[model samples]
Target: MSGKPGPSAAAVLPELPVTFRPVRTRVVLLTVGAGLLVVLTVVALMMPSGGAQPWGPGDRATMIITGLLIFALLAVLSRPKVVADDDGITVVNLVASRRLEWAEVVKVNLRTGDPWVYLDLTDGTSLAAMGIQPGGGRDQAVRAARQLRALAEARGTGQPGTR
Candidate 1:
C-alpha cells in the first residue's frame, strides 16, 4: 500500500453534530424581549394607585401578563435552529420541527434574496430551514448554506450546484 495518506474526509466535511442558528436574530430578539419585560415591570410598578381607573393588583398582573405574551412571541422568532449529525438533520422552525435522514434531503439551496435556506426533500416538497437566514448575517448564512450543501452531497443523495 502507498505510504501517502488519502484526502481526509473531515477536511472536506464540516464537523458533524454542527448546529446552525441566526446569531444576530437570536441576540436581538432575546435581548429586546428581556428589555421590554424589564420596562414593563418598571412601568407596572410606577403606575399610580389613586388614578381615575385605579391601577389595582389585577391591572398590574394584566400588564405583566401582556409583556410576557409579547416576550413569548419574540422567543418563537428566535427558535429557528438546525442540527446536523451522523444520523441525520433536524430542522426547527418558528412553529415546527422535523428530523430527516440524509437520504431524505435532495438539495440545499439559499438563493439571493431568499430569507433562509430551503431543503429539497425526496418527497418532492421543499422544507424551509429558517435556522440560516441572510437577514441576520448575510455572509454567514451563505457559508452555512454551502456547508450544508457540501454535507448533503458528501453524505446523502443530493446533487451539488452553484447555489
Candidate 2:
C-alpha cells in the first residue's frame, strides 16, 4: 500500500445518521396531490343533477376514489429517501428499500443530467439512490453525492480511487 495517508473521515465525510431526500419534489408532489383531491371532491359534491342519469351516491364515491388513487400515486412519487449511519445506509425508493453496509459500496456517482445518485456495489450491480435526485435540486444533489462518496471511500472494503 502507498505510504501516503488518505483524507480523514472528519474532514470529508458528512455527519453520520444523516438523511437525504428530494425536498422540492416531495413538497410539490404532496401539495399538488392535496389540491387535486380537494378540487375533485368539491366538484363531485357540487355538480348539478340535471341529466337523466344524474350523479348518484355511486358516482360521487367513484370521484372520491379517483382522487384518493391520484393522491396515493403522488405519495409514492415522494417516498424516495436515504438514511445513513455509522453501520450502513438504507435506501428507500418508490417501491422498495435496501440496506447496504459500507464495505459493500464501491463508489457513489451522480453524473450530469442523471436523475439521481447511484451506488456501485461490490457485487457488480449499481443501485439508484432516488433520494438524491437532480430533478428536485441540482446543487443539493451534488453535495449529497459528494458526501456519500466520501463516506464510501473512507469506509468501503474496496480499494480506494474506485470512485
Candidate 1 pairs with clashing backbones: none
Please report how far candidate 2 places residue 40 from its true position, in Å. 0.5
List the pairs of residues colliding in candidate 2. Answer: none
Q: What digit string (tens of lDDT, one per residue) describes model 1 on residues 84-104?
A: 999889999999999999988
Off by over 4 Å in 1: 1-12, 51-53
- Where does candidate 2 stray beyond 4 Å? 1-12, 49-53
lDDT of 2 by residue, 82-159 (tens): 998999899999999999999999877777777898888999999999999888778788778777777777777855
TM-score for candidate 2: 0.88
TM-scores, each model vs. reference: 0.89, 0.88
What are the Cα lDDT values of the candidates?
0.83, 0.83
Best by TM-score: 1
Q: Considering summed lDDT, which 10 consecutive residues are worst modelled in model 2?
A: 1-10
